[model samples]
Target chain A: MATEVLQQDAQAPARAATLYHIENPEVENKAERFLNAFAAVLHFTDYKALLDSYCASSAKCGRCVASCQVYQVSRDPRDIPCYRSNLLLDVYRRHFTVGGWLKAHIGGGWSLTDALVDEMADIFYRCTACRRCTLECPLGIDHGLITRLGRYILSMAGIAPKALQVSVREQLEGETRNTSKLPEPALVDTLEFLAEEMAESLGVKLEFPLDQPDRDYGFFCAVSDYLMEPDTLMGNAAVLYAAGDWDRWTIGSRNFDAINYGLFYSDWHLERIIKRLVGEAKRLRAGTLLIGECGHASRSACQFVPVFAGQDELPVKSFIEYTLECIEDERIHLDPDIVTEKVTYHDPCNIARSGWIVEQPRRILRSFVKDFVEMTPHGRTNYCCGGGGGLVSMDETHEWRMKVAGRVKAEQIRATEAEIVVAPCANCKKQLKELVDYHELPCRVMGLHDLVLRAIDIPGGKSARQRQDEAALAATA
Target chain B: MEHWLELARGPLFAFTFLVMGLGLARHVLLQVHGLVTRKGQRLRQAPWRRIASSTLSWAVPVGHLDRSTLVMTTASFLFHIGAVVVPVFLAAHVALWSGFLGVSLPALGEGAADLLTALTIVCVLVLVAYRLMTPRARALTRASDYGVLGLVLVPFLSGFLAAHPTLNPLPWSWMMLLHILSAELLLLAIPFTKLAHVVLFPFDRLSEVHWQLRPGAGDRVAAALYGEEAHV
Candidate 1:
């Protein structure tokens, strides 16, 4: 019933309280397609159990209102997580359950009209799917999961947003085979340039090994790292190099990008992407799939890999976890003296929402930085940077993201008064950088590894002047 | 007037109670069947420990006792306690249930039941006022939510007046009829409406145990949606 577009308002928007129309089509049955999608969703899997439970349950307590950043910012009724979820659950109750049948037969009941479809499309996409409400819900109703299910059903009806749809198509079938359209040669060139830049600046040279066989860590970072966040890639590379002899890991030539936008929407894409990734990892005989500083990417892998590949095929490890292990083992020494500024960390919702990667990064941060202050309600209760669930990728929503979506997060970040906000997730980093910039906040937003790249000590690493003198000495000889 | 009370408290009451019991039981059985039938769909073992702990922890849900929600949550907890205890443990309702099925628990004393009933009414009024005043709650509340709250109040209020005959505005027979009828209506509504969450909320956490979307199902979904040539 939620159909209205978000207007500039602090009060929550009311959804379609009464649905009157049912669609009747002569050429194509969109309602039929939606119901078919619903039926297929029910028939092919056990999501029905969840749908049934959520429909029968979901107490409409509005306690989730306290946790939703969007609702907190916009104060629109439509943004309330449970209300947003009700747009889908009400349909389930009306059409799929016996009680709904009675309501339709005895009295006027809701039908899947074009307006309702449009409403679901508009409202479901509006959520960040951070799952903070899941924690707040006394009944444990996962409004975030329901939001994803709504999107999944909508995408099946060919009603997904253009940005998400096009990117997945390109990653699966496009020539470059990654979301960023980063060509292999260009990737190699970028890595070489980064390596050269590091050599010239810090006298550190790390290898960007590609397609090497039987490595221990098959590196899969956000493919965007090749184009945008190069420091994260270099930091991961440097960390891995300093941890081992540096030859035990390789960035597989095939399917190295780990940002699975499928995790944002469609399971078909999630499964397909993971299969391609596992195929690459298996092809390399890599021991573990080492994910870079992307939160959603790491989560989609750590949780869904075993769902597709079973328990024994491959293990997935985040860069944070691996770096923590290295630090613990004294394999990589972080020079605490390098970072002197006040710093705080933003727990990417995907990683820390479930208490998975909460402390590992903090332990790593405290090992180096000075005057680390946590954002209010940090850790598992941490607010999303407002660009989660692939919201940051929609370049069109830049204004809304900064103003409405990211408002609470911006407030939280500003309250901390920390200079550097080390966000580990790709989407969080992009959204937060824009957030801080648009708000004119004093803090700098960067990846956790971006700072770690400055703080880590490389053994036998020469200074830029030493390398310069060597060049001169070689020339003289 | 006596006939009206007799009708509400007798076969009509039995019918509504039966509907609620059978309806809720059917839901439980259907969910179980839904879970068990899917055992063949996938071969993964259930993560029993995570599921068990998650379901139980939300029983108290102390974590949700943040500063903002503390009052509402505490009221909700107390209101629910009153709603359940006053009905089942009341000396009068126990005699009726014992008469029906020859089974009864130790009933609360008359004064205790009166106090709890007053408390339940006060809590419901607080809850209703909160829902009405709070914009977020008002936004979430449909007509059904208000109806359920009103339905809850009817039985408790009417019963209270009936018990303390001195306070009764209506005749004894009318108060009894109102109490009996409203209570039955509430029973009939519980299994079919959002009130079902009273029993079904735990199922929300346990739903993942049946998450057996077998290996090739994604491809099947792709084929079903985007045709056989759809990219996996």
Candidate 2:
């Protein structure tokens, strides 16, 4: 029987809907007042000086574009960061120039009005804030940083979409990271159901240790995988367990979700999510923090957590690195016969483009798949699936999301005729699936962990029952 | 002749008075509008020395001014010297201002003023050429750069030609009028372009240097950038 594990929550609580909204009147009012005051005093000198001193110097080189997946896929002129940033650049010129002032008095400031704010809001949100552009830019002018600041500007003007605002608020208040806010009790029930389903399917009893004390490793996975990406989540567990390292690892019941809200709007929100994960790790007494196959989550662990929360000495490892390390240490062994199809690896932006991580995922992929074809623009320069920067959870921007964000990614996948696409990040997985489906591309999306699980050999070789079953299955065939 | 001087006094007073008045108005408009579009909120007091140095350093070049703002300040210093010297030295402009203000300073001879006019022409050309050539300036340079240059150049060039008075009566008067008109255009452009940076640069530089000399400035820059909460 073909077996499939569906979306399951570990335990959900019965409580008020965790969907948050922009409710702080004080913050909102202050933000609005500041923006209005700022607009009134803007001048050409201050504007140009700012560009020359800070922005121009950093964004001077074009190396950061090498990290964008969208540019890799579509090869479109407008998809690049420089072109997109120029849209904002035009507005600055028209309002601040002497000729601009003269033109405005003659009614030429029409473009500087509210309508342009809406367009800016749309364009900035389309970016995933993955920091891929920073890798290519010579001065390290982080495109992600600028994009976040732009989002803040748009939000203050009331030009931001309600869905994103709501999601950001919810995540800020410690709600579930995913759109579907399944509470604690509900998540617990779902985990129980998955335990039974896994037992029946594989004929092996599996124990998912939650809140286990003195665990050496802190196991963190994306909220999306626990709900929507089942194969990837279970495959992660299976790989760990088969290597007999599962006994040393434990998942926390209270804060198992590793989704970083910093990927969305506010620095405050990013800090909130990372702090929760860190607190959980400390509670479990885990020495090493094992990050699952999520790009931004690992980045938050490796980069933002230390910076924002003042945690410097934590051992953070991505799943790819963890898997590779285990393989190198001779802990986890694989049988390559299981995966017969040709595969091409799609490098998630955070892991491939960001400086902290690289190489491990490709090495792991090489081990399992017989033939791994590289995409036209692979690694750091890969395209965003349009689901980054919290757009996947944002419901209102779905149409624009599909049209503008995934347009390049859809083209990139179509160019590659490979049968399977392996993306590590959960959000990337969702974005890729929808983009592929929308474009009517013929390819199956699989996580790197899922491939590893299939190729990983069970402990002590094949059992007597497995040998008998293979013979019996051969006779039937 | 006294009656003629009185008649010209109203025009001179109106033009100079308006130029001085509108300069303040431009500053007010920029401050109010700039605050409206700004996103972040920071309350900072202006630093005195930085302001003084930047004001003093206005003589430095736009590209590099290692203690001496090199090329920019050099050309600008010449430009200002010409502006001050030519008008005070020129027999015609001094005569006009004296008609209104009832005051007179030592006047240069026609030969000396004419030589000063030629020097002013050279400085204006150098400034315009520099704006066009430098890449940093090129990226920032707009049509206004040329327009402002034209405003100053037209008046100076016409005055130079009109001084000889070889042209017919009507053309001579017309050229003089065109020269005055371009000067007015330049005065209007001064508060608007990156030329406005002339006024803003002093305040910005003062604040930057002031902050740099303060205790723990290095730690603050890193902490602010890295999201560390520690106060430097």
Candidate 3:
């Protein structure tokens, strides 16, 4: 009777919340081959050893379950951090442990079936790899690590989310220079258009320096910002102009996008993306690589650049850090009276938990915003924006992401009652925007630099009347 | 019963300690070897002071456990303290340790040890109830969870019965032997079960910090596997 149940469960297609449709046999075969090859690799041997060490002693305290955003909303036993990790641990034990070895021989141990693989793929991807759970765990069992490791294994099998894989592949091998598939000509035209818009609206001339060699910094941002977040770009350009560091920074012509989807899916992709960033920096001989307000991008570059690029000779600084430094030095003055709306900042999980970039954004916000409020559990303890772990790009998972994973973040924002919520990370902004609409909350999501743009006092620019006239003229054209 | 008590106190006791010592040492050695031989990206400099402070803070129930799970945290803390203190400070255990190590440690008074043992038993019972009743805990709980609880309860119950001989249905010698045998089993199970956290907690926390704060040989390994240049 138990065997029948097991067989039925194994044969049933997983109906759990998943971003990928897994009915294709060709894809399944590819995934199986990839897993087998990955399993065979000696490079992963140390990982296996490490996984075995921590997993065996898991206390299953459920402290991690309370910390997880997904588990908090779904209340699903499968969503529990330890339980999710146990899926992989079970596979490891069944194949590796002496007791499990005997059980296998006696036909009593669990086997890795296709349904198990599908289920594993589904649940592992549900985790955002936020590492908040690590903070609460007594043993500090990093379920985030387990999640990523599981994803990496799944990715090898070609069992990853289609959106992430497509973006990563395009960035690495597509005709376009970046993941947005924007050709260089289109990129140039977009920049020229943005500069004109900035000049007309912000009354400042924004020059996107292309392929300038030996600049002090090479700026990279999410490619989507070019089209989706023109104001954020305008704000960034305005700050640079006001700070008089315009000449020191250049956006690379070949590699303007800093967004690394590889950070979400696989080490192979992560390595490829990191290498491109490094190669671009070296090619330009830029002293520093300035990552724009994208959380995972900032973390990926800061944390993995040294490892992947082989040297931290070129430092990686987040645009938030740069803005804060300008504020601290009084390089750019802000009019505190410019905006009176109550504002709060959302700390992106990658920035706060993984990269320790919590205070810099708050410091920036405190300088200009007269009424700054903090979310109840702000900073490292803050929930994910629901679009984390590349969910923002996975359109299939948007409903689940909004309803389950992003629900806590929505509640946090609602509690703040701040008219404007400043989220520096692009992914967070996307999720928070949708969350604002979905939750029907009276709130607006803006970038940190968007707020900076509103308050910045750009000298020798057009007057309000003249800027309004130019904007009207541009709109007419 | 006398023969069983004598065997538990002598050869069985020695054998359990030997197995425990060897098992724990092997476990520690394996972890150390993995750390030493770990390839790829070099870890970022660890904030030693912060790590120490964080470890100390987590040792108690103050901030580490969430507000929702405070009851379980309190039970866990009490159970751990009682579990360690009752066994080590009991007069008979102290005498055994003194005999084995040639160093005499202070022993708890019989009344105090009995009170602690009883309180500890209650704490374990509370924890077991928490596991059974809480939906999340029940989901996570396995046979090993109940097995570990039983392993802990047997020794404490037996020790309490042996100390207050009037309460036990079994002979005094039999109760004493059961106490020793159960304790031996617990020690033998330590390196192989969830109880390995006794030896692994500090190291696990450190490993987490290393992974989070620093980069490791990811690039080097990738370069070796794929190539020095970007695949594109």
Query: Best candidate per lDDT, number?
Result: 1
DockQ of 3: 0.44
What is the fraction of true interface contacts found in candidate 2?
Answer: 0.00
Off by more than 4 A, model 3: A1-17, A22-25, A29-38, A462-477, B40-50, B207-232
User: If chain B of candidate 2 is superposed on the true chain B, what is its TM-score?
Assistant: 0.62
Query: Every model's DockQ, to 2 decimals?
Result: 0.51, 0.03, 0.44
Question: Cα lDDT for residue A324, model 3?
Answer: 89
TM-score of each: 0.90, 0.58, 0.92
The complex in candidate 2 yields a DockQ of 0.03
Whose DockQ is greatest here?
1
Tell me how candidate 3 scores on lDDT: 0.78
lDDT of 1 by residue, A1-477 (tens): 232222222134464331111122222565677778877776776688678877886779889999998988888888899888888887788889888899888987657665566567777877888989887787878787888888888777666666777778778888877888888889889979888876664566666788999888899998888888878877887787678747988887668789888787777788788888888899999999999999999988887787777544699999999999999999988877767899999999999987889999999999888789999899989999988888888776677778888999999999999999999988899999999889999989999998888877666675324544576698999
Rank by TM-score (best first): 3, 1, 2
Superposing all C-alpha atoms, what RMSD in Å does each candidate have to the true structure? Answer: 4.9, 15.2, 3.4
Q: iRMS value of model 3?
A: 4.4
> What's the lDDT for residue B37 in model 3?
61
